[model samples]
Structure formats: C-alpha cells, structure tokens
Target: MKPLPPTLRENRRYLLLRITPATLEADERELYFAVSDAVTALFGDTIAAEVHTATIVREGEYLILRCRRGREDTLCTAIATIRSVNGTPVHLTTISTSGTIKALRRGIRAERKGNSIICTINEAERTGILYADEKIDLIRRDMKGQDVVFLTKDDMEIFHATTTITDGI
Candidate 1:
C-alpha cells in the first residue's frame, strides 16, 4: 500500500507535558484514558473525535501527546482540566508544543540535563535529583515497591546520611 504524501497527510502537533508530583504510577493506557475523558467531558464526543488525541510517547515523568494541529488549543484546555489519573492526584503542565517529534525530544533532553544525588534516610536508600526553584525529587525502592517523595532542599537536609554524590546519575 502506498503511504499518503506529505501534503495529503494529516497535520498534527505534539505536546510535551511534565507530570507533577512526577511519581504517579499510572501507565500509558491510564494516561490516555484520562486525557480522552477530559477532552470528551469538556467538548463532548464529537469534538473529542475531531481532536483525535493520542499518546505518542511516555518517558519517565514526561509525556508526548499528539493531536490535530489546529485543535491544539482545545486539547490544551482539556489537558488542564485533568486533575487525576487512576485515582491519584496529578497535575499536568505543558512544557512545549512542536510540529516535529525531534524538537520535542530535544526539549526533553534539555530538561533532564542534571545528575541525581543519592541519599540515605532512616537507613533506606533513595536517589535524589535536583530541580529548579530548589526542589528535589527523591525515589526510594525496596522489596515492597517504589516510593517517591518530593521535598525542598531544607527538608532533605534533615535526613540522615545524605552525603553521597553518585556519579553518572
């Protein structure tokens, strides 16, 4: 089968969003449903179909969503209405929007340019990464599962044995 030519192909835009709290365990399917529901709820089924919202890629706490190019505004509005996914409270902040996947991927790389610091709190090991505004994201993994904690630099300093600065993140 022949593929559609560039001019005949549907125009789409990719939106990069940063998921806050950044620790939600929701999978791609859950995220898609959440987005779909938000769009439908805000614009109804017909408009939702017209928007054709889809999840293109999910990397760590960043998500790339595809939607009809001209409908991006409506989609962004819908995305803002999404407050939770799978019963867990989450906030999605749109980082950037682009017509090419390459540009969006570059943005993701730029956003993840720093190494993470390792810390030991109450004898449990956790990996910490510094974010802007003096915020830190810590992830602790154990036999049970993974636990993610977001705290300020001041709060993290109170933890015990948080002196190690691991190399290569």
Candidate 2:
C-alpha cells in the first residue's frame, strides 16, 4: 500500500524530555514500555489508544516522543506520572514541544554546547556541566565520581576562580 500523502496524514507533535541525573542508563525499549505503562495506567486504554505515543529518538540524556497533535497535553501528563524506569528512579523533564523534529534537534544541539565550564572547587579545577533545571554536575579527575550541585546559572560565583568558601570560613 502507498503511504499517506501529507494532506491525508495525521498531525503529530514531538516532545523533548531530559532524563534527570543524565547518567541513568536505560534501553529504548524499556523506556518506551515505561512510558506506555504510565499512559495506560493514568488515562486507561481508550485515551492511551488515541494518544499512541511513540519514542522516536533517544540521544544521550534526551528522548523525543511523538504523539497525535491534539493529544500532546495528554501524553505530557502521562509522562509526568512516570517515576522509575527498570527499577532506577528518574525524573523526565519536558524541555520543549515542537511540531517538527528538526527544530527540537537544533535546540538540543544548542543545549549541549554551552553548559560546560571549567571552575575551581576544593583547590582543584573541575569541569561543571549545567542541566536544564538549574542543576550542575561537577566532574572529578578520574571521571568516576560526580557531585550534583543544585544551583542556578546566577550561582556560578560559588565556584570562584581562586577561592572556595569553606564551612569554617
């Protein structure tokens, strides 16, 4: 059978979700199931069938979900209900919703480019990468240990170039 023409096709919307911690590794299939379950449990079979959410892209800590255009809100609400994936607790923050994947991908590129900076912490220089929700992850020398610091973009001063405030100071 021939594919449906643009005018005959159903309208769809794409959602970009940022996986919290940015380190919790999850499989695409597993993630899809988790989302499907959330939608089904929260809205029941009828709405779930109408939404027909699908995970189209999974890049690093980001996931692109597609659903019928009008059901975007419903899908997002279902996504908010998800608490864990494969036993790992995680929070999926909806970064943006777009009508086209190209636009969302462009935003993701810009997002990944500028959040990193070199700063001094504990007299040692570390690389800090900021997340969408005003959180920063400082990478250690060995890259084995990372500390999540909850701070906004304006709070970068905490990691001063030459000095760090100590508890006793």
In candidate 2, residue 146 scores what lDDT? Answer: 38
Compared with the true structure, what per-residue lDDT tens digits does model 1 show for residues 1-169? 9999999989999999998866578878899999999999999999999999999878888999999989999999999999888866689988899999899988784444434788778887778776666677787767756556777778866774463667835
Task: Give the TM-score (vs. native) of candidate 2.
Answer: 0.66
TM-score of each: 0.71, 0.66
lDDT for model 2: 0.76
How much is 100 displaced in model 2, in angstroms? 0.8
* Cα-based lDDT at residue 120, candidate 2: 69
lDDT of each: 0.83, 0.76
Q: Give the least accurate 10-residue stretch of model 2, judged by summed lDDT.
A: 160-169
